[model samples]
Target: MRLIPNMISSLPSSLLRRAAFVVLIFGGLAACQKNDASAGQVTGTLNDAAQAAGQKLDQAASYVGQQVDATKATAQQNLDSASAPSINIDPAALASSAQANLQNAASTANAQLGKAASITGQGLEAAGRKLQAWSAQNATSSASSSASSSGSSSASADSSDAQKQMDK
Candidate 1:
């Protein structure tokens, strides 16, 4: 009572006026009608929106699960098919074909080796003939240049022996 008035008197007049203004504004706001119906409508709308979102999420999850199951089934089917034998092979026929190819290769190699041997033999024979002719020519020349007939005869005999040995 007296204490409150004494406190108010101790405050500045400008501070008192500001306090009164704040109190009047708050009191006026409190006297206004609050629309409870709109609040309830907003709350209901929020709940409905939340329920719709939840339903959409559930549907999306179901669709994804279905797609995953379908994919798994397709993969399993592919795996099963892959495990089954698709190509037929006959071991006996394959062995017979390989044996024939080996026989043909062996015959071809033998023919080629025989031809090479024949060509080598002919070349060796021709080289031996040429060496013998050259040796005979050298022996004749040396015998003719010797001082004695005996030495020439001996050299001719040696050349003939060498030629005979080469022929054999």
Candidate 2:
């Protein structure tokens, strides 16, 4: 009879210890999840492209989905004359969002547009970052904005040299 009372008393403490352990485990898991959610984040600036350049880019990009080769000439025109506004980008976030957008697009044509826009935005953003980085390193703002194959490294270097003298 006495032992029964003792066992009952010990039972509550044992249960309490188990409960504390469970709470600790749950809290740890929650914290770990939060940390994971915050990882692989990208930070950057927004793009405010010139109205004309933006419109041309949109048209050319949309056309690309329908006529990849047919837009070649028009794409050149847009790129050649574009004094487009700048759009900054964060590569990590763009990649993740683009991934999600691509998954969503697997169902329909409208989704495909979303996919296209996402892809275009990501590409432009990445290009912008690269251009900005190059300009910063080389002390010049003239990186070829051309989307065509003719944009060569030598041309970029020459342009940078010319821009330096022009800046003076």
The prediction achieving the highest lDDT against the true structure is: 1
TM-score of 2: 0.23
Q: Which lDDT value does model 1 have at 132?
A: 52
Give the Cα lDDT of each candidate: 0.44, 0.40
Please report, as a residue range, the 10-residue window in candidate 2 with the lowest summed lDDT. 34-43
Error of 1 at 85 (Å): 3.3
What root-mean-square deviation over C-alphas does model 2 reach? Answer: 29.6
Q: For model 1, name the residue pairs that clash.
A: none
Candidate 2, residue 25: how far the Cα is off, in Å: 48
Q: Clashes in model 2: which pairs?
A: 47-87, 50-85
User: Deviation in angstroms for 47 in model 1?
Assistant: 99
The per-prediction tally of clashing pairs is 0, 2
Instruction: For candidate 2, give the lDDT.
Output: 0.40
